[model samples]
Target: MSSFAALRRAHADARFKCIFLRPTLASQRLGCPVSPFSCRLNSSTSESHVSDAPTEETPIVASEKTVPSGDDTLFHKALTPSGRRDLADRIIQDGKELHKLNVELKNLQRFARSTELLVKGSPWKVAKHWFATPFKEDVTLDNGVIRVGSQTVPNIWLRDNCQCNSCMHQETRQRLLDTFSIPEDISIKTAAEFRTAIEVTWSDGHQSTYDKDLLREAGANSEKKAVIRQGQVDIHLWNASIAESKPQLNWEPESRPHEKRVDKFIQGVLQRIRRFGFCYVNRMKATPEATEKLLRRIAFIRETHYGGFYDFTADLASKDTAYTNIALGAHTDNTYFSDPAGLQAFHLLSHTDGKGGASLLVDGFKAAEELLHSDKEAYHILATVHVHGHASGNDGISIQPYKGFPVLEHDAETGALLRVRWNPSDRAAVELPLEEVGKWYAAARKFDAILKRKENEYWEQLQPGTLLIFDNWRVLHGRSAFTGKRRICGGYINRDDWISKYKMLHFGKEDVLKNLAAG
Candidate 1:
C-alpha cells in the first residue's frame, strides 16, 4: 500500500479504538459484569458486545462523527456506510491539499538552498554543491548590491520577470507566468555578476539581464516621485509685479527662422508656461486662422459652442458676456464644463481705438492656499461642498452648462492644493441650509477678497500681435470694459494632450513602470 494509504488506515484504527473500545477493569468497576463484552487492552480496536441484548427486529447502527481542530481534523469511530464514504473522500481531499502545500514549502526550501540566493562567500553549502547550474549569461556586483540583470533583484524576482516568448505575450508585452505556474523547484541555470549588472540563464533556459541603477529607481526609493506627476503645474503665485517681466516669449519670425531657432522659441514658450502658468507671445499675424496655427503648435484646439476659437469683437447672438464689451470677472473660461479646459489661449488680433480693456489675471491656487491657511474650516467647507455652475439662454443653440466642483480641489492624501475653480457669474443659485448658507457666503466672500486683492492681480493692456496663454484651472482671467473696437481670437487645448506632450519631453522612471504594467 502507498504510504498515505497506510497512514490513513492507522489513523482510522486509532480513532476506532478511541470510540468503541474500553478497558476491562473500567467495565468491572462500573458493575457491568465483564463477560465476552470485555475489551482487550493491547489491541487498538477490541470489539465487544453490549450486555443489553438487541431484539430480533432491531440492529445496532454504526456511525462516524467528525470534529475540527485549529488546522486539522479528527474522526470518531463506529462508521456507517455513508460515513465511511465521507471519511474516504475527506482523507483523499485533505491528502491532496496537504501535498500541494508541502510542495510549495519544499520549493521555498530549495530556493534557499541554491547558491544563487546566497551572499558572496556563503558558508551554507560546500563549494562542490554550489555550482549545480551553469550559464553563458553574465552577472555583476554594483554599489553594495548583487545585480541580476541591471537590478539588484532576488532570484525569484528574476525568475518572475522572465520575458521570453513563452513567458510574455508578444502583442501586449505582459508577463504570462503566475506564482503557482512558477514551480517551487525553479532556479538559476547559470549566473554571474559583473561591475555594472547581473545576468542569469534561468533553469527554463531563458536568459535575462538587469541594470543596477534602474532597479533602485524602479522601487523602494520611489515614494517622492510617485506623488508628483509630470506635466502637473507647479504654480508660482504672482501679483501685479508679474507684468513687469511677466512670463513673455517672442513668436517665431514672420520670415520663418531656421528650424533650430523655431525649436528654441517653442521650447522657451512651453517652459515659461510651466514656470509661471501663463505666457505672452509676440509678433503673430492678426487673423483668426493665424492665431489657431500658433496655438496648435502647443496643442490641439478645444472646441465648444463658442466654436474653435473666440473672436472677442463686438458680436450679437452668443449668450456669453465675453461677446459684449462689459467688464468681466477673473474666472476660468469653462466653469460649467465637467472637465474644464486645462489651458486657455488668447491672441489679440487687433485693438484699434479702444480704451480700458486691460486683461487681469489672478492665481486662484495662490488665493485658495491663503484661504486654506487663514480659515482651515472654511477651506474644508469649500473643498467639501459641491458648487454648481451653469449657463443658458434662449439663443436657438440648445446648450446649457451644468457642472459641479469644489472651489478648491485638493489632493486627498496629502491635502496639497491641486486645481482651483471659482467663477461667480456662472455659479448656479445655491440652495444650502439656513445655517450653512451664511458660512458658505462668508467663505466665498473671503476667497473673492483674496482674488481681488491688488497683491494678487496682474493687469496688462495687451497690444496687437500678442498671444496670451494660461492654465485656466490654476489662473483666472478677466477683462476691463472697453469702449471701441477690440478684436481677439484664440482656442483651447485639452489638458491631457498637453500633459502627454510634457511627459514625452520629461519622461521619468515611474512613467516607464506604469507603461510596462499597462501593457
Candidate 2:
C-alpha cells in the first residue's frame, strides 16, 4: 500500500475503535452497533494506543457539554483548563455586569439628548423664566408693560442694539448705525396690543423681533437716548508703533554747533526712547566732547566715579581708569545703587586690534510681553515675587536694595509697561512661604527662557567712534570677551533728562512738568 493510504487507514481505524470499541456499553445503550473488525483491532492494538485515542475524543465530548466533569461546562473547558472553574465563572459574571452597564449608559444618553432639545428650543425664554422671574415680578413697567415690582422694562425691545461682530465690526469700529442714537418719538398704539417682543421697524421698514433682556441691557427703558462715540484714542498706539519705526543713531561732536540734521536726529532718538524705551547712536568719534554733547542733549547726566574725559587704550598706563577690563553679561549697570541709572551711554573711543568685543542689546519689554501671552498665571507669580541683588564681597560700598517692583511692571493709570527685571546671575533667593517658593521658581524659569531667545537679541560690533544709548530700565546690555585690547568710554544719563529734552524739541518750549501733572 502507498504511504499516504496507509496513514489514512491508520487514522480511520483509531477513530472507529475510540467511537465504538472503547465505550462498548455506552455505544450499545445509544443503539450504535459495534463492528466486529473495530472490536478485533481494539483487542490487537496496545492499551497505550487505545488510551491516546480515547483521551483525544474525550476533549470533544467535554466541548459538547454531553458529560458534566466536576460542574465545569464545555465552554469553560475550551477557554481554560477544567481546574480553573472559579476563574471562568468570574469572567462570565463580569460579562453580564458589563452588559447591564451598557444598557444604563444608553438610557442616560437618551435622556440627555431629550433635555438638550428642550433647552435649545427657547434658551433665552427658559433662562428668563428660571432666574429672572423673582426679580422681574418685583419690577414695574409703564404703558404697554405691566407692573412686576421696582424695575421697569420697555415693551418694545430694540433689535439693532447688539454687540456681536456682525452688528458691530470690531476691527473697523463700525456699528450697524453710524450715529448710534436712540429714537426720539417712541409711542405705544395700545397697551393690550403690545407683546413681550415688539416688532422693531427700522428706518427702511424691515421688522425683526428682539428679546426683552437684550433691550434692557441696551438701555431701551432709560429716559436719556444713547449715542455711541466712534473715534476714541487707542492707548496701544504708543507701544504698537515702536517696532514699526526705523531705528536711528546720531553721531556729532559736542564742541561743534548742532546742525539741523543732528537736531532732527536727536529729536527722533528721544521720541523713540519715549515710545519704545530704547535707541542707538553710531558713527561719532569716542572723544569726551562727543560723549558730553550727546549726554548734554539729554535732560540730565548722572556722573559716576573716575568721571570726565577718558580713553580706553590698552597700555596699562593709559589715563582712562574708568573703563575696566572685565567682560560683562547682559545687565542694567548700577542695579546695586539706590536709584539705578535709568539711561546708559557708551562711546567706543578705539577698539584697535580687538579680536572679539561685540555689544549686545535685548529688549526686556518685548521678552516680558512674550511671557505674558504664553502663561498669564506664571506671569502673575513673577510679578508678585520679590527679587534681591547685591555686590558686597569685593566692593566695600553696599547698595540700597530693591523691593515690591514687578518683573513686568505696568502703569496703573495708563496701562503702559514701566520696567523689566531680567538679571539671572545676580538674582538673590527670594524669601517666600514654603508653599509659594516652588511656584516662584517655575515663573522665573519661564521668564528666563524667553529672555535668552536668539530672535530677541540685537548685536553689533562697537567700532571706533560709535556711541550707543539705551534706557537702562528697559534694555539689558552686554558684550563678548575680546582677545586683543578693547576700550570703551561709557556713562549714565537719567531718563528724566532724556524725556525733558524730547519734549522741549517736539512740543516747543512748553513746560513738561505742567503737561505731565495735568495728565
Candidate 3:
C-alpha cells in the first residue's frame, strides 16, 4: 500500500478503539463491572468492528448497556478523584485525535478532487498537487506543443519564456536568453508533469519548468487577454457635476503616530487622479518646496525649457502667455512638445489685489465623446487629421514635434481614446492640403464648441494653501484674466513615471508587471 493508504488505515483503527473501547476500559478500571450480556456484545462487536471502517455514523463510545448502569451517573460516581482527573485528560486526548482525523479526511478529499481533475481535465488548476494529462489522442509528447490538461503551449514560447536564473536575470528580471537562436520548428524531447509543476526538455536538450500560474497564462484565450488589459485604472468621465463632489485629499500632519497617513494620502491622490484625471490636495503648506516635495512622492519632476519645479508670479518671466495676467481659454499645456507632460500641478501661493482669476478645467475626454456621438464625420476628421503646435515665444528657442499628431489619439487594438492634444494659443500654421483644409476647420469648430459648452466647464477659484494636480493629457486647464500679483508654484511630472507608480499601487506585487518591466 502507498504511504497515504497505510497512514489512513492506521487512523481508522486508532479512531475505532478510541471511540468504542475507551468507555468500557475506563468503566472497568473505575470498578463498574461489565455484565455478562454487555461483555459478550462488546467482544462480538469489537471483533467484527476491527475490519469495519470508521465513519461519521460510528458511535463516539460503546453503548450504555455495556456499563453496569442506565446512565453515566453510576460510572462517574464510581470514579475516585484521581480517576476523574484521568478520565478528563483522556477525553481531551481523544478530542485532539478526532481533530487530527478530521483534518486528514479533508486532505484526502482534496487529493481525490485533484485526481478527478487530472482525469477529466481542466483549463487551469491551482491545487497544491496538480497534474496534467494529454489534451487529445493525436497530441503526443514529442510534438511541437505540450498539453497541460486542456491548454496547449508551444515549445518555442515555453523555451523563450523560461524563468530559470540562467534564462532570466534574477535581480533585473530581464531575459538573457537569445530568443531568436531557438529554432522556429523546435520540438519537445520529453515532458514530465510533477505534483506542483511541469518540466519540459526541448529538442535541443534545454529544460524548462513552469508552475501552474505561468502555464495558465501561456495559454490564455482572447477573452481573458482583454479582461487582463482592461483590469487596470478605471476611467470615470465627468463634466461640471464633478465640481459639486470634488475629488480631494486632505494633507495630514507628519507626526509619528500618523505616519501611515502619508501612504493613504498618496494612494488616495493617485486613485482620484486616475479615475477623474484631477484631484485637489487641500490644507497644504502652500510653499514651493512643500509642493515639490509632495509631487515627488509620485514621480520625479519633468523638466521643460521653462524650468523644473517652477514658482513664478504673473510677470511674464518665461516669455509665455501663461506667465501673463490674461484670460487663457481651455487648453492643455506643452502641446508643442513631442511627448507632452503627463501631470501638472498648480498652487495659488498668494494673490494680492486679484478678483477674477478662477481656474477653469474641462474634461477633454467627455467633450471628445460628445463630438463622436453628435457628429461622427467631425470626430473622424479630428481623429484622422494631424495638427502642429509650437512654443517659440522664448528668444532663440522653438520647440515642436518633428511631425504633427492627431487631436484625438486612440489605442489601435482596443479602439479606446488614449489622448487629447489641443492648444489654440500655441497652435502653429495650418499645413493641411487645400481640399482638406475646409473640412479640418469645420471639425475644429465643432470640437471647440463642445469644449466651450457651459455645462462642460468646471470652475474653481483655487484657494491659498490648496494644491490642484490634473492630467494634462486629458483635462484642459485655463484661468480667467485678473489684475493682481498672483504667485503660483507648481511643476509637471513625466507621464511614464506617474503611470508606473499608479500601476504598482493598483496591482501590488503580481506578474502584471512582467510585461511592463520589459517595456
How high a TM-score does candidate 2 get? 0.48
TM values, all candidates: 0.61, 0.48, 0.68
Better of 1 and 3 by lDDT: 3
Best by TM-score: 3
Q: After the best TM-score superposition of candidate 3, give how far the Cα of residue 83 lies from its true spot, in angstroms.
A: 99
The TM-score obtained by model 1 is 0.61
The RMSD of every model to the true structure, in order and in angstroms, is 19.0, 25.9, 27.9
Instruction: Estimate, for each residue in 1-519, the C-alpha lDDT of model 3 and write its tens digit.
Output: 533243334445444544444344422332212211122224323333222222334432445544543556534432344444444444445556555554455445546543443453311211101212211222223344566456566667788888788898877777899999999988877778665567888888888877655565445432233333432344677899998999998888645325356766787898798778899999888799889989998899988889899889889678898999989999998889879999999999999975789999999988987886687667766776688999998899899888888898764433456689999988885666676489888999999999999999999999988999998989999889999799899999987777777766665646554433212
User: What tens digits encode model 1's per-residue C-alpha lDDT throughout 187-265?
Assistant: 7776666565567677767777655343433342221233224343344667778878888877877686676676567
Q: Lowest summed-lDDT stretch of 10 residues in model 1?
A: 30-39
* lDDT on C-alpha atoms for all candidate structures: 0.60, 0.50, 0.69
Query: Scored by Cα lDDT, where does model 3 land?
Result: 0.69
For model 1, the stretches where C-alpha displacement exceeds 4 angstroms are: 1-208, 220-223, 226-228, 232-235, 257-260, 394-403, 413-415, 429-437, 506-519
How would the candidate models be sorted by TM-score, starting from the highest?
3, 1, 2
Over the stretch 28-126, how does candidate 2's per-residue lDDT look in tens digits?
232212211122223333232222212232333333223333445433333344423443344344344444544455445545543442443322222
Sort all candidates by lDDT, best to worst: 3, 1, 2
Total backbone collisions, model 3: 0
Worst 10 residues of 2 by lDDT: 223-232
